[model samples]
Target chain A: MQVTVTTRTRSSSIAGYAAIALIVIGLALPAFASRSLIQDLFFILTMLTLAQLWNLIAGYGGMVSVGQQAFVGIGAYAMFAGVILWGMDPVPAILLGGVAGFLLAIPMAFFAFRLQGAYFAIGTWVIAEVTRLIIAQWKTLGGGTGTSLPREATSDIMGVEAIAQLFGLRDAAARDVLAYWLALLLAVGTMAAIYALLRSRTGLALAAVRDNDNAAQSVGVDARRVKWMVFLAAATMTGLVGALIYVQTARISPDAAFSVTTWTAYVIFIAVIGGIGRLEGPILGVLVFWGLQTAFSDYGSWYLLALGLIAIAVMLLAPRGLWGLIADRWGIALFPVQRRLILEGTRHG
Target chain B: MIWLDTVVQGVLLGGLYALFAAGLSLVFGIMRLVNLAHGDLIVASAFLILIVVETLGLNPFLAALVAAPALFALGWALQRFVLNRVLGKDILPPLLVTFGLSVALQNGMLELFSADSQRIAAGPLESASIDLGIVTVGTMPLLTFASAVLVIFLLNRLFYSTALGRAFRATSDDAVTASLMGINPKSVFAIATGLAMVIVTIAALYLGMRANFDPSVGPARLIYAFEAVIIGGLGSLWGTLIGGAIIGVAQTVGAQLNPEWQILAGHLAFLVVLILRPRGLFPRAVD
Candidate 1:
C-alpha cells in the first residue's frame, strides 16, 4: 500500500480554474467598464487587499492588531512625501509606502508584542493614534488639514499617459484605470503570496504557533520569529494598499488616512464576515462589503449602524463566518490548506 | 509654581481618566474580558444622563443617579446575553464582538444625536471654583476627583469584604473550580458587568460635564481608559489609579510645552511605561 500527502482537493482544482477566469475578467474590466464601475472595482480590490493582509496577521498569525491604520496612514504619507518632497513619481512612491510600513512595523511590533491577547489590540491602537497625531504636525503636508497631490503629480503618473492613450480616455479616468490595475494586481498578488506562504514550511509553523504557542514552542517552532515575520509582511502589504488608496483620491488628510473606522474596523468586518483563518474568506467578504456599501451607503450613520449589527450577529451566530458556514455544509474548500493522506493501491498485508 | 499648578491640574484630570478606567479594570479583573465597547458605553451612559437631565429638569449628578440603574441593567443584559457566550479560551470572539458593539453603539448614537458635540449643562456649578492658596481648582474637577476616589474605595470594599467579591476572585482565578463550588460563572459575570456599568455612569457624569462630546470621541476615551488600565497593571485597582495619574500628568505637561503634544504625550508615556515595565507597575495576574 502507498500513501500520498496532498493539499489539493477536487473542488480546489476547480476553484483554481474559476479564479484564473475571474482574474482575466478583472484585468479586462477597465476596457469595457464605465468610469464609476472602474472606481468601484478599485475600491473593492484595494479593500480586498487590506482585508487579506489583516486576515493573515489576525486570522493566521494570531496577532489581532486593531492599529492597522498606522501602517496605512504612514504608507500614504510616505508616498506623498516621496512625490512632494523627493520629486519621485507616484507609481514608484507606492514602493516607498511599503518600505515605510516595514520600517514602522519593526518599532510597532517591539512595543505591541509585549502585551498579550486583548491588550495587544489596545497597544496597537495607541501606536496608531500617536502616529496620526504626529503626522498631523507635519506642516509641509498641510498640517492637520492634510494636502492634495500636486495636479501635475496626479496627471503625470507613470502609466497614466499610456493608459489614457490606450483606452482613449481623459487623464482623470485613465488615472482611475491605472489605480484599478494596480489594485487588481495587488489583490491578486496578495492572494497568491498568502496562498504560497501558507503552503510553505513557515506557514505550517505559523498555524502550529497560532493553535498552541506553548505546544508549538515545545515542538521547536520559533513562535516569536514567525509572528514577527507575519506582522511585517502584513504591514508592508497594508502600507502599499494605503498608498494606492490615497493616490486614487489624490488627497491625503491625517484624519481620513488614519481613521480607525475606515481602515481597521471595515477591514476587520470584511475578514470576520467572510471568514477568518481562510484565504478565500476575504475575497468573498470584500464582495459582500461592497454590495452592502452600494445598497445602504446613502443612509449615512444608519448604514454604519447596520454594518455593526451585521458584524455582531455574524460574530455571535456564525463565528466562522459565511464561508465557514458554506464550507462546513458543502465540504468545499476553494483554498484548502489541510493536508490529506490519500491511500493508493491498497494491498492485503 | 507653574509646574506645580500643571501637576495639580494633571492629577485632577487623572481622576477623570481613573473614572473612565475603573469600570474597565473591574470587568477585566473579574472576567478577563476586555470590553472594547467600554468607551462607547461611557459615551452612551453620558447621553442617557443627558436625556434624563433634559427631560426631567434634574441636576446632572441626579440624572446620573437615575441613569445608573438602567445602565446596570443594560450591562447585565449585555453580558448575560451577548458577552457571556463569547467568553472562553479563544480571545477572538469577545474582542471582535465588543469591537462590533463599539462601532454599532457609536453609529447608533450618531444617528440619534447627529455629529454635533453636546454637553450636559451644569449652570454655574460648571464654572465654580475653589481657592487652595497655591493653586485654585474648579469645583467640578475637585468633585470628579473625589468621586473617583470614592468609587475606587467602595470598589475595594466590595471586592475584599463581600461574598460577591469572593465569587469574582474565585471565578477570575479559575472558572472551572469556581463552578464546581456551585458558583454560576455566567451570573457572576453578568453582575460584574452590571457593577462596572454603575461605575461607568459615574464616569459619564463627569465626562459629559467636563467637555463637549460627539459619537466620535468614544474611541479616544477608550484609548485613555485602556492606557490607564495598562499602566496600572492588570487586575490591580490602585495601579489603575496611578496609571491614570501618570497619563494625566503626561498630557498636562506635554500641553504646557505644546498644545498639540497633549494626547501624543499621554500615548508616548504609555509606550515608555510598556517598554520599561511590560508587566505594568502593579501587575496582579501571573499570566
Candidate 2:
C-alpha cells in the first residue's frame, strides 16, 4: 500500500471545534460571571496571549528572551501616551502599543540579534532596563512615579457606555466587561494568526530553523529573515497584550510596567511547565500556574520556591513538558500542525 | 582635581562591578551556562554573611570568610544536582531552569529576610578616606579595589598554573574527550561553580557594605554584571576589569552631569561597545 500525507487528524478537527465552542463560551462569560470572575478571565486571556507570544518566539523560533517586558512596558507606556498625551481613544491607543513595539523592535533586534545563544537573552534584558530607565524620565507621564488614566478617559472610554447599557451594569463593571471583551478579541486573534502562520510555508521554515539553523540554511530556508520576522511579530503581539494589561489596571509606572519578574519570569514559568513548542502547551501551563497561584499564593515565597522546584523537576524528568507527557502517552495531538503519512489503501480511522 | 577625583572614584566603583562580573565570567567560560540566578545568588551570599555577622557578632570580613565556604557547598550541590542535568544541546532548559531559580531565590530571600534593605556595618571604614595630592579616595573603595585585584590575580594563577585548572580547560574544550582522558565533567563543572560562588561571596561582602541591599536588588545587580561581562568580552577575566572600569567611569561622569543619567550612561557605553565590538573588547581566541 502507498502512503499519503495529510496535516489533518481526527483529534485536530475535534480540537478545532472545541476551540470554537470555547470562544463562544468566552464571549458569553461576562453575562453570567461576576465582575471579579470577568476580571480574572481577563488576566488569564492576556497572560495566555503573552504565553503564546513567548512560545512562538522562544519555543518555535528558538530565540529565548528574558526581556519581553521591554515590549510590554513600552507598549503600556505608548498606550498611556496615546490616551493621556494625544487624547486618542483607548481602543485605538492599544493598537498604537503594537506599532510602538514594532518600531522599537527594529533597533532592539538589530542590537540583540548580534548576539547568539545565552548572550542574546542578557542582551535583551539590558535593553529592557535601558528602556525602563529612559521611560522613567518622561515627566509628562509622572516621571519616576507613575500616573493613572484621567477621569475623563476611564469614564468615557469607548464602548463602556454601550456595554453598560447592554448588561445593565454600572460604569466600573462595564469598563471591566469592555476590557474583558477586548482581551478576548485580542487573544483569539493572536491564536488564529499563530495557527494560520504555523500552517503556512513560513511555518515549515520556522520549524526547520528551530530544528537546526545550519541545516535549514543548507536547505535554503533563509534562517535569519525568518528569525527577524518571528522576533518582530512576537514583539508586536506582546506589546498589544502589555497595553491591554495596563488598560485593565488603568495605571502605569516604570517599576510596575517593566517588572521582569512579573512580566517575563512568570510567563517563562508557564510556558516551560505547560510545554514549550506546542500550541496547547501555554494553555495548559497558564491554567496550572494560575491554579497553583490561587492555591498557594498565601504562603508568599514558598509559592515561588515550589514553582522553581517544579520547573526544574519538569526540565529534568520531562523536558517536553506536561502536555508533551500526555501526548506521548495517549498519542493525542489537539492542534496537530505536523504532517503525517497514512497508507492510501488502508482506512486507519 | 575634581575630574581626577571623579575618574579615580569611577575606577574604584568599577572595581566593585568587576568583582560582581568575575564569578559570572568564570562559570560562563567553563560551562557556557549563564546563571540567571547569579544576581540573586550574590544577594543570597550577602544574606549569609549578614546572618553570621548579626548572630555571631563578627565583622563583615570574618563573616565573609565563613559565608564563602557555605556558598561553595550550595553552588556545588546546585551544579551537580540541578544545573548539570539541563546542560545539553538545547539552550532553553538551562535558561528556563535558572530563570525559575532566580524567581525562587528572590522570593525565598524575601521570605527569610523580609524586604527591608540592610547594610553591613563596616565600623570606621565606612567613612574613612585617604588624601592623595590630586584625588582623595575612600578607604573602603580602595580596599574593595585591592580585594578585587587580589581575587583576579589568584583566580588567574589557579586557572593558568594548576592541575585542576588544566582539567577545567580540557573539560570546557570538549566534555566527552575530556572524559576519555580520565576527567569527570560533572565534578569539574561542580568545582567551577563552587569556585564561582567563592567569588560571589567576595562580591557580596562589598555589595552589602557599599549600599543597602534587599531581596529584589539581585536582578539589577545582575544587569551590571552582565554589561561588564559583555563589555569586557565573555570569557576574559582581565577584560571584565576594564569593562567594569568603563561602566564605573561612565556612571560617575553621568552622575556629574545629571543624577538621573548615571545608570543610563553605563548602559549607553555598553551599547556602544556592543555596536563597536559585538564579541566584546577582549574576545577569547577559541570562540
Candidate 3:
C-alpha cells in the first residue's frame, strides 16, 4: 500500500493547457482587435491585478484594508515624480512606484498594525484620506488639480520607438500597444507570482495566521512578521499596478488617483464576488464585473446600485463566492493550492 | 481673545463630530460589528428628513421627530434581517456586507437625489447667533452642542440604568452566556441598532442644518466619526466627545496656521494619538 500527496488534478492540467492557448491568443490580439477592445482588455488586466493583490491581503492574510487607494495614489505619484523630476524613463519610474509603496507601507503599518479587526480597515482609510489631503497641497505636482505626464516623458518614453518599429505601428498606436503588452506582462506576472507564493512554505504560514493568529503564534508562525511581509508585498504590487495604470492614461489627479470607488471598492467587489482566497476567482470576477459594466452602465447610478446589491447578496448567500459555488459543486480547481493526500492502497503500517 | 474664540468654536464643532460618533460607538461597542454603511445611513436619514420637511413644509426639528422613528424601524429591520445573519466569529462577512450596504446606499441616494447638495433651510436659525461674554456663538452650533450632550447623557442612562441596557451589557460581555440567561442577543442587537439610528437622526438633523449634504458626503463623515471613536477609546462614550473635541481643535488650529492644513492637521493628530496609545485613549478593559 502506498500514500501519495499531490496538489494537482486532471482539471488543473487541462486548465494549464487552456491557459497557454489563451496567452497565445492574447499575444496575437493586437493584430486583429480594435483599439477599444485593446483598451478594455487593459482595463480588465489592470483590475485583475489589483483584485489579486487585494485578495492576497484580505483573503489569505486576514487584513481587510479599505485604504489600498493610498498605495495606488502614491505609486502613481511616484512614477510621475520619477519621470518629471529625475528624468527617469517612464518604465523604470514604475518600479520606483513600487518602492514608494513599500516605503509608505512602513508608516501605514506602524499606525494601522496597532489596531485589530474593523478598526484596522477604517484606520487605513483615514490614512489614505490624509495622504490625499497632504498630496493635494503639494504645489510641485499641480497641487489639488493634478497634472499630465510631460510630452517628452510620454512620447519619448524608452522602448516606445522600438516597440513601434517592431509592431510596424504609428506613434499613438505604438504607445497603446506598448501599454497593452506591459499590462499583459503585469497580469501574467502577478498571477504567476501569487500562485507560486501560495504553494510555498510562507504561504502556509500566512494561512495559519489568518485562521488563528494566537494559535499560529503558539505553533511558532511569527504572525506579526507574516502580516508585515504580506502588507508590504501587497502594497508594492498595488503600487506597481497603480503606476502602470496612470502611465497608460498619461494623467494624474489626487482625487482620481486615490479614489476609493475605483482602486479599493471595485477591487474588493471583484475579489469577493469571484470567490476570495482562490487564485482563479479574481479573473472570473473581473470578467463578470466588466460584463456588468458593459451591459448595464448606461443606467448610471442604478448600475452601481445593482453592483452593490449583488455584492451584498453574494456575501450573505455565498460567502465563498461564485467560483466557490462552482468548485464545491464540480470539484474542479484550475489553480489548486490546497494540498490533498491520496491513499493508493490503504495499507496498515 | 481670538485664540479663545477659536478654541471655543472648535469645542462646539466637536459636539457635532461627537454626535456623528455616538451611534457608531454604541453599535460597535455592543456588537463588535463596524457598520461601514454608518455614514451613508446618516446621510440617508438626512434625506429622509428633507423629504418630510419638503412634503409637510414643517420645521426641520419637527421633521426630525418624524424621521427618527422611521429610521429606528429601518435600523431594526436591517439588523434583525441583514446584519444579524452575518454576525459571529468571522469578521470579514459583516465588514464586506456593510461595505456593500454603504455602496448601495450611496448610489441609491445619488439616484434619488441626483447628486445635488441639499439643506434643511432652518429660516434665520441657520444664521442666528448669540454673543457670549468672550466669544459670539451661532444659535445652531450651540443647539448642536447641547443636543449632543443630551443624546450622550440619555444613552448613558439607557446603557447603565435600564433592564434593556443590562441585556445589552450582558450580551456584549458574553453572547453565549447571555443567551443561556434567556436573553435574545439578536433582538438586543436590533434594539441597539434602533437606538443608534435615533442618534443618527439627531446627527443628521444638525448636519443638514449646519451644512450642505449630498449622497457622497457619507464616507467623509464616517471618517470623522471613526477618528473620534478611536481617539476617545473604543466603547467609552464620554471619551468620544473629548476625541471629537481634539480633532475639532486640531483642525481649527491648523486652519489658523494655514487654511490648507485643516483636515491634514486633524489626521496628523489622530496618527499621533494612535502612536501614543495603540488601543485608543480609553479602550474597554476586556475584548
* DockQ leader: 1
In order of appearance, the predictions have TM-scores of 0.98, 0.98, 0.97
Backbone clashes in model 1, listed as residue pairs: B232-B239
Error (Å) of candidate 2 at residue A99 is 0.6
Candidate 1 lDDT, B1-287, residue by residue in tens: 99999999999999999999999999998788989899999999999999999999999989998998899999999999999989898899999899899999999999899999999999998999999999999999999988988999998898889999899888888899999999999999999999999999999999999899888898898899989988999889989989999999999999999999999999999999999998789998655
In the order shown, the candidates' DockQ scores are 0.84, 0.82, 0.81
Candidate 3, after superposition: displacement of residue A18 in Å? 1.5
Please report the interface RMSD of model 1 to 1 decimal. 0.9
Docking class of 2: high
Q: Please give the lDDT score at residue A122 for candidate 2.
A: 89
lDDT of 2 by residue, A1-349 (tens): 6788888888888998999999999999888899988988898989899999999999999988988999999999999999999998887899999998998899999988888888889889989999999999999998889999998988888889998999899999999998999999988998899988898889999989989989999988999899999999999999999999988899899999999988998888888888999989989988988888889978876887888878888888999999999999998888788887888877464
**Tens-digit lDDT track of model 3 for A168-270:** 7787787787788888988898888888889998999999999999999998898899899989999998999999999999999999999998899889999
Clashing pairs in 2: none
- Residue pairs clashing in model 3 are none
Q: Per-residue lDDT for B96-120 in model 2, tens only?
A: 8898888888888889889999998
Kindly report the docking quality category of candidate 1.
high
- What are the per-residue Cα lDDT tens digits for candidate 1 across A1-349? 7888888888999999999999999898888899999999999989999999999999999999999999999999999999999988998899999999999999999988888998899899999999999999999998899999998888788978898889899999999999999999999999999999999999999999999999999999999999999999999999999999998989999999999999999999999999999987888888888888899888887877778888889989999999999998998998889888778874221
Which residue runs does candidate 2 get wrong by more than 4 Å?
A: A1-3
Candidate 3, residue A306: Cα displacement in angstroms equals 0.8
